[model samples]
Target chain A: MATQQTQLLARTLLTPAVALLFIWMIVPLALTIYFATLHYNLLDPGSESFVGLENFRYFLTDPAFLASLQNTLVLVGSVLAITILLGVPLALLLDQQVVGLSIVRLMVIAPFFVMPTVSALVWKNLLMHPVSGLFAWIAHLFGLPAIDWFNDAPLFSVILIISWQWLPFATLILLTALQSLDEEQKEAAEMDGASALSAFIYITLPHLARPITVVILIETIFLLTVFAEIFVTTGGGPGLQTTNIAFLIYSQALIQYDVGSASAGGLVAVVLANIVAFFLVRIVGRNLEA
Target chain B: MARMVTTRHKVISTVAAWLVGFLIFFPILWMVLASFKTELEAFAIPPSFLFFHWTTENYVTVQERSDYLHHALNSIIIAGGSTLIAMLIAIPAAWSMAFSPTKRTKDVLLWMLSTKMMPPVGVLVPIYLIYRNLGLLDTRTGLVFILCLGNLPIVIWMLFTYFKEIPKDILEAARMDGATIGRELIYVLTPMAVPGLASTLLLNLILAWNEAFWTLNLSTLEAAPLTVFIASYSSPEGLFWAKLSAASTLAIAPILVLGWFSQRQLVRGLTFGAVK
Candidate 1:
């Protein structure tokens, strides 16, 4: 009897959130679909007319679309790989008993807290400045010529900045997973004379499988939409070398004010993000349930 | 002998870990140091580490050139207000989902999360139009509402985890003693889950605070947060390294200090169930 009452309350309480989320989804898609089918613009309503699939065709055919799409994939995939590679080892290191580990943990996580805009500026100006930046100074001291990071290696530079910020998150999540590993299982492996690397490979790696997926899925979702780094350092340039889909959409929506093309691009980004989310739901959604 | 070798190994690991820690932290350290340098010293080709002439001129210029305080206030108001409002809505929602069991509950949770998966750009048109229609452009209230909406699913998910760890029988006993639903949520559930809720609040504030895309797009001048404040430093007049660092330092100092104080709670909350 009490369960029924609680269930009814649950339904009532969730009604508003569920309804609002639904509206948020439907209204946006409806407007996007409408815009995609027309030449809608904030500047000129008089020129509006039905031009079905032209915007889509133009967007799909544009080289900018494919370039940004490829860049987006590379950006997301590369960051995911770097963060995991760096994060897992860092997690293992931190999980071990160490003096000043707390302080070290604090230092590592500090990058994640810095606002993206500020960090991007810091990197672009202070660390990647070919003449005046730290990397330049280091190179000069080693008798090597300085590399202009943004001009020469825009994508790689942006990836480095992003990976620096996100590595802390991966580390913390995986470290938490590491700490939760069964002590007995580890001890059993040790008693069997298993090397530390082998133990980590067999036992610890499997334990972290879920979190690694989560770290990738969550990071991929954000990375596909990386903007602040691009906005600050490269502006998706050195001739559109670093433009991701999100930046591409922003240029269409705001820079060009081509709402029709922008909406179509936005819809494409949504479809791609949802595919990743579907996989994430299979992993993380089950964890939430458990 | 074996114990002594193990002790030696622990020492080596500690030293190695601290070195890695210093390397990771060196960039922010460089920025802060740059903020104190004169522009010439800041832009020195060799990148002055400690031998540079230090000055407060960049900070002074940053203050004179930009409305730093106004942007800081906006960052606080928007991030704090949004997270507070999200907590208000999410707590009750999480409570219901946590204490109540249903076949559809997991589906509901996943659905809420699916909304997060939708890229913000996808809905920029409709949202922008709606904001323009409602006169919410460049307004704190609009930014707060959107930010709150954006983080609500994560808020509920985190709160649900925290509340689930709490045994439901304790709340039931409160009900048996004639505690109303309101009394149960406010008096019983909240206090018990304070740590979890606190971290949820902290993490949400951090997420909202670092948010750049919405804060940048939605607000040009009036509602621009610290992200915009930092972005303003970029212009065609050649980049000013010292001044930019000062601006960046001012933008991040408050949140960074807060994170330092609450690192333990933040880590614990984030890793809540993932490890265990």
Candidate 2:
């Protein structure tokens, strides 16, 4: 039996959360939009003036913007590719009967739990340092030159570190999906004399599609704004070689003290993320009814 | 012949899985090992795999030299405080949506999730400026406020999903018995909802603990958590490999244990119940 009292109570219960999130989302965003059109610089006070679209124009034309935009895309795209490609096989392997399964799963998933700064610094100094890193030592053992990771291929290093962190996430999701698969369906496939490869191509991957999409969308949202790894490892450098959009906006506002340009860059990032969010919201929306 | 083949198959796959797992886990394992070594041996060329003179000196040095406990305490307060507040705010909202179906409930949930998608950097400038003007920068209160808001959507979503699973029949049964609403919550609902609430709390705690952007941007020293504290080592001073390893080991050890416990809930919470 529906009652007006219950509905009113429900709205009352929801009011605080709704109102708080509303303010949290709107206030900063409104400020960002307002700040974007100004010539605001924290360093030089009282220089604030209306500079409509000039900040955007400068930010759009800046070489750092283009490079960072490319870096952001490459970082996101490469990590996605690596995680999915490796995750599928890893998930499949884990789904098999294995001794010490729990321990293996823990070990496999351990890196995702490591904080970004710790992982980045560890990889930088402990394993990737040219002169003394484990990788260098291993190369030296083979009578090869120690390849400098951060200096030589900073973006690649960042990509590799992030991929390591995300691989566990992809694998864990895919594995969960794989575990739920009907055993009878797999048996039915085997009875049809389906080769393992064919069964995987047909039964396994198709079952995995939804979860894979979930993994991709969720990971993309986080990956597109990967800041901590870049912050600690390269500081967006060797030059601007490893700067992503998130880090780019950060430098503009905080380091360069250019709020107007930073706000514009911030909106650009919001637009890019919203494009991904559009698809994600649709998918999650569809699932809400289920 | 069939049994032998099955055994062989399991053996080969297990071996392969272990190899890959070890490879994936090698970096973290190597770091943990380095934490146990002396400064000279931490980054020594031809890195020692085993049989090194293990020492606990780095751990002691890291704490004594750098006030590790202070940052650790900050992490506890910030993460713990945010999780508690988010849970408090979210539980009511999630409970209402779960119990009372409205035409707009779906829209509200999706809208909330959309807020999370707005990249934090998009609003970093305003937040920084606002915090500065309000004198909230470098304060645990500011971190808690921001993080609580940031994670509220997730908390609500997770709790909503969990609450939705509690069968409506039981609550109706309790209502029909003339139990008051408050009594119904305290008696019937709380028991079943406890697991969901706990999991959501654990997962949100982990997320807040590792959050870097706002913490890094806003807090300098007074309120820097282990994330900021560990990042401080990334400067030229990061050359102290043993100390870095020791600090990192301490930083991740608690969360890793907590994370492992909450892995199942993590997938559900992170994916917004999309996969589950």
Candidate 3:
């Protein structure tokens, strides 16, 4: 009876958080869905009417939607590839007995903490500006023409800035995974006359596999909705060159005040994100057991 | 277990690692240096690495022009307020789940995690409309509420992970000694949970501080935080590099320090204990 009472108390304790989260998750989502089907525009309030699937049709057929969709994929894919590629080697290097390991680690991780707006502005104005930027200065020394980063290649510049922010996350997680690897296993491989490269391929790489997947999934979740960097630097512009789905929806709602179509675009983003989240939740769920 | 390696190899690895570290850190270092330079010198050709005539004029000008302290204070309140509120709700939920876990506990936890996966953009339209109708747009209260909900899952999950590690034996011992539930919590659990609580607070504060999307979308001048403050510099009109750098530096410096201290908690909180 005492245990039963405690269990009831436990249920009571859990209710507030559960109720709040449920309301938070469901209400806005339901409204978004409801509005997606209406002819709602902030600019033309009190005129909302049922227009089933019209917003979706318009959003889907729009040229900007296709371009933004493509940009979204490329942005997520390229940033993931760059971070993981650089991160693996960086993690291995940090895992070694390097001099001043803490300082070096801190330096590498510093970029991750810089706010997206600061990093984006710093990159655009101080580093990537064609004539007065650091890259231009460097090019001048090398006798090469300066490339206007935002204009010449907008998407790639966004990727580079984002990759810098996320590289530390991947590296830090991979390093944690690396630190947990058993020394005896590597020693055993050495005893068996296995080459260093072969041992890494067989043992080390396998240990990092799970962390790498976790990194990829988590990064994908954030990367799909990269907003501030694009907002600050490119404004999704020089033509929809850098406008990922998040920026597209942002522009649609705030810039153009088209709530119905933006809601439709928002749903498309949700579906895309959910596909990634499904895999991520499964991975995290399995890890919960361990 | 120590493995023997040649001094030469170690030296080579150190050099290579530092080089990579410096390359990664250069942008932030450059920004900091640029903040101290004159407007004319900030955009100097050949980009003065360390030899620039340093000045505090940019910092002064940035503060004077934009009222940097006002937005900064907003950042503090919003980030701090949201984190405190989230912790308040999350602690009891996490405590119950951690200590008195039932058959459905795992599912409940996973479901909370799933809510985090719901993209903010998915609800952007409704939130905007709701805030507009309620006249809550450009209010710190609105941003705080949204940010709190946004981070509550991670806060609860982190607290759950921490609370679960506290041995149940202690609580049972206190119960046998005739301690009431309230007394048991105050006397026994609170002391053990303090460090975990501190780290969780630090990590959540950092996350909330750097949260840009909602803050950007929902806020304008009245309640704008550092993210919006820095973004206002995007439009180029004149020699604004030094001033922009000054604002950016001020915006990031506090959180960057907090972030460094909470690096371990960050990995665990963000990865949901998958990596750690």
Q: Which lDDT tens digits does candidate 2 get at residues A66-143? A: 999999999999999999999999999999999888989999999999999999999989988988899999899899
What's the true lDDT of residue A39 in model 1? 85
Q: Write the per-residue lDDT of candidate 3 for residues A48-120, one digit (tens) a residue.
A: 8999999999999999999999999999999999999999999999988799999998999999899899999
- For each candidate, report its DockQ versus the true two-chain complex: 0.66, 0.85, 0.82
Candidate 1 off by > 4 Å: A1-5, B236-239, B261-276
Give lDDT tens digits, candidate 1, residues B1-276: 999988998998899899999999988999999899887778777666788777888878887888778888999999999999888888778888888858988898878888888899888877887898999999999999999988888888888888788997898799889998888878987789998888889888988999988887888789998988788776632358888888888888889987776665555444334434
Best DockQ goes to which candidate? 2
**Prediction 2 global C-alpha lDDT:** 0.94
For model 3 chain A, the run of ten residues with the poorest summed lDDT:
A281-290
lDDT of 1: 0.85
For each candidate, the alpha-carbon lDDT, in order, equals 0.85, 0.94, 0.93
- The candidate maximizing TM-score is 2
At residue B194, give the lDDT of candidate 3.
99
Q: What TM-score does chain B of candidate 1 reach?
A: 0.91
Ranking by DockQ: 2, 3, 1
